[model samples]
Target chain A: MIFPPDSLEAIIFNALSETVESMVFEEVVINQFVANKWPQVENSAWWACIELFPPPISGEVIIVVPDALMNRFTEATLGMGDEPPLAEENADALGELLNTLCGRLLAMRVGPTHTFRMGLPKIGRGDTMTQEGNNHKLVDCLVEDDHIYLVVPNQFWDFNAD
Target chain B: MLKILIADDSKTARMIIQRCLEMVGVANCEYVHASDGIEALTIMRAGGVDLLITDLNMPNLDGKGLLLAVKSSPKLTNTPVIVISSLVNQALEIELNSLGVNSIINKPVSPVKLLECMESIMEKGFIS
Candidate 1:
C-alpha cells in the first residue's frame, strides 16, 4: 500500500482541511459518529466525482455535500452576499472543489516525482451513493453543522507494497 | 493598463484567480476570460494581451497546447504565461519550465502565494 491505513486516513483529513480552508475559508473536522453509512441529511445533496489516472493505480474520488452547505460554499467562493448563486455557479464551485481536492489527495499519496492525470470533475445531485467494496475508504467530515464525505477506492494506494 | 487573459473551463476558478490577482495589488488591469485553450489562443492572437494565466486541464487545446501556440508565435512569445493548476508535480513542473512558463501555482491559491509568484516574475521583468 502507498500508506498504512492510519496514514492514509491522516492524508485524507489533511488534504480536505487544506483545500476547504483555502478555497472557502472554512474549517473541517472528522465526523466521528457516522463510521460506515452515509450521513442522513434532511436536504438533498450534491456530489462531484473525478477520476485519477496514475497508470496502474487508478481510482475515483467523490465528494458529497448537502444543498445548504453547498449553497454557502458557492456564495463564499463567488463572494456573493445575500444574493443567491445561480445553478451553474453552484455546479462550478463543486467541480472546482473536487478538482482541487482530488489533485491534492493524489499528490500527497504519490509524492513529488510521480506524475498523474485527472479527468474533469463531474457534478450531480442525487441521493447518497454508496460504494460496496471491501477496498473503499471514506472520510466523513463536518464543516460546521454540515456533513461532507470523501470517498475513494482503497486500490488507489496499492502501488506501494511497503 | 495591463491586459491579462485567464483561461479555465471552470468559471469559479477564473473568478478566484482574478480575485487573487487583485488581492496581490495588481490594479488597473483589464481581464479577459476564455473557457478553453483554443479560445485563449485566439484571444492572444488578437493582440493587446499583456499576460496569460491559464489552468493546465481544459477542453479543446489544453494549457500545454496553448503554451506551445503562444511560445511558437513570434508575436506572442514575449508575453509571459503563468499556469495555475491542481495537477502540479515534479514532472509537470519540469515540463512547464521547459516550455517557458513564467510561474506555476497550485490550486486553492492564496493571495500570498500568488503575490510571491508575481513578485518573482516582476523581478525578472516579465510583468510590470
Candidate 2:
C-alpha cells in the first residue's frame, strides 16, 4: 500500500522535536528525510531496538546511535553536565526514549489504542542484525544537526490470524 | 472530557501528541503518559483509558504487542485504539483488524486529522 510519506516524515520529526527540545531546553529542527540500508539480524555496534507487534502484524524499529552520540543524547536529554550517564547503564532510559520517538510515528499510522506491546528495551554494543522486510526501510534524521539513524521494518502484518 | 493516553518510547512523541490534542480543541481532557506497553497496560489494569492513542513501535513492549495485550484483557478490550507509525503496512492493517483495532491513522499526525479521529472515537465512546 502507498502510505503518506510526507506526513510520516512530519510525524517522525514532531515526536523527535518535542523530546529533543525538552531534554535540551531548546528547539531543534529535524533535518530533511534521508534513507539508508539496514540489516535484519543483530549486529555488534551498540544499538537500541523497539518492536511493534500489531497482532498478526509485526514490525521492527531499530535505532543505532554511535556510542559517542548515545552518550551525548543521554547527557543532553537528561541535562547532564559531563561525566554523563553511561548508555549501557542507562539502557532503560535510552530504551524508553527510542520507544517514545518510535511511538509517535506509529501512533499517527496505527491510531490510538492500536498500539503494539513494548518489550524490555535491549542494549548491546555489538551483535549486528542485518535483514530487511518488504516493509522494512530506513529513515535518517538530523536533530540539531546531529544525525540519527532509524530502521523501519517492512513486515507484512497478518490480519487473518485469529 | 476526552480521556486520552499517549503511549510511546519518546518523550518527544508524547509532547507532540499532547500539543496536537490541545491544538485540536481537546481541552478539559485528562491525558496520561506511558513509556512503553507495560506502562500503558499498567494504567489500563488499574482502570483503562477511554481511548488509546499510541505508536506501533516502542520499548518494554512495542505497539502491536500492546494491542494484543489490550485485546486479550477483558477490562481493556473495548478501549478504542489508534496506531501511528512511520511504516504503514497494509498487511499489518489486516492483522490489526483481526485483533479488533477500531482505526489506523498513518504517522506525521496533524492537528486537524487528530481532531477528526478524536471526535469519531468520542462519538463512539458515547454510544457504547
Candidate 3:
C-alpha cells in the first residue's frame, strides 16, 4: 500500500519533534514550506547521516543543524548547559540524536511488525557536510527562529519514485 | 551493588544510560560496557551481570541475536534484558514480548520511564 504524501510528511515531522524534545530538551514545530537555504553558522554546520534498509522503505536520513544548535545540544546531552562545548561530544550527540530520530520515524511509518535495519550513524561538520549532488529531500522543522534539516537522499527514494 | 551490562556501539549512548541509571537512584551498582552485541555476550558469559540493557542496532550480533542467545542459555535465562532502541513498532513490541524480553525502552530514553522499568523489574524480579 502506498502511503499518502501528507501522512509521510506528518510522520517525519512528528518524529523530528519528539526526538528534539527528548534528546535536546528543545521543542520544534514542522513548517509546511521548504527553506531557501541550509541552516549554517559562520560557514559551519553539523550533520548526522543514517542508512535505513528493507521493510516500509529503504533510504538514508540525514539531519543537519546549525553550529549554535549543536552547542546547545551538546550541553543538554551532557547535563552541563553552562559549560563550553566539546567537539567530539557535540558530534556524538548529533549522531545519536539522528539515530534515534531515524529509528522512531521508521517505526511510526511501518508499525511494530515490520522491522528495519538501521546503519550506524556518522557525523560531519562544515562545508563537507553539505555536498552539492544528492542532498535534495528536506524535513524543515522550526526550532525557535532556527531550523533543523532532515534529508533523505534521492538514491534511497528512487525505489518509490513514480 | 548490582552488576549491570550496557551494550551500544555508541559511547555517548552507553554514557547516557549509565547516567540515567544513577539519576534513578541506582547508586549501588557496577557497570560492564560493550560496544556491540558480540562483546556484550562475551561479558555476559564472564558472569555477574544482574541486568542487561542493550541497543537493537549494533555492529556484530545485534540485540535480537543477543536476546536469543541469552534466552537459550541455562545460566543466562534468569537474567532480565531491557532493550533500548529507536526502532519500535507494534510488531517489534509483540515479538520482543514473545521472545521473553523484560522491556523495550525507546532511544532518547526518558529518565522517568527508565526509572519505572527499573523499579518494576527490581520489585517483580523479572518481566516474565
Candidate 2 residue runs with Cα over 4 Å from true position = A1-162, B125-128
In model 3, the runs with Cα more than 4 Å from the true position are A1-6, A32-43, A130-136, A153-162
Pick the winner on DockQ between candidates 1 and 2. 1
Q: What is the lDDT of residue A93 in candidate 3?
A: 86
lDDT of 3 at A35: 29
lDDT of 3 at B45: 95
Name model 1 segments beyond 4 Å from true.
Answer: A1-6, A32-43, A128-135
Predicted chain B of candidate 3, TM-score versus the true chain B: 0.95
- Angstrom error of the Cα, residue B52, model 1: value is 0.5
Alpha-carbon deviation at B91 in model 1, angstroms: 2.1
Best by DockQ: 1
Instruction: Enumerate the candidates' DockQ scores in order.
Output: 0.81, 0.09, 0.72
lDDT top scorer: 1
Ranking of all predicted structures according to TM-score, beginning with the best and ending with the worst: 1, 3, 2
Sort every candidate by DockQ, greatest first.
Answer: 1, 3, 2
- Please give, for residues A1-162, the per-residue lDDT of candidate 1 as tens digits: 133555767777778889999888899998742333543433368888887775635777788888888999999988998888887899999999999988888777777777788889888777545455455566677898887887776665566723
Task: For each candidate in the order shown, give its overall lDDT on alpha carbons.
Answer: 0.84, 0.63, 0.79
Pairs clashing within candidate 3: A112-B89, A112-B90, A112-B91, A112-B92, A113-B91
**Chain B TM, every candidate:** 0.97, 0.89, 0.95
Query: Which candidate has the top score in TM-score?
Result: 1
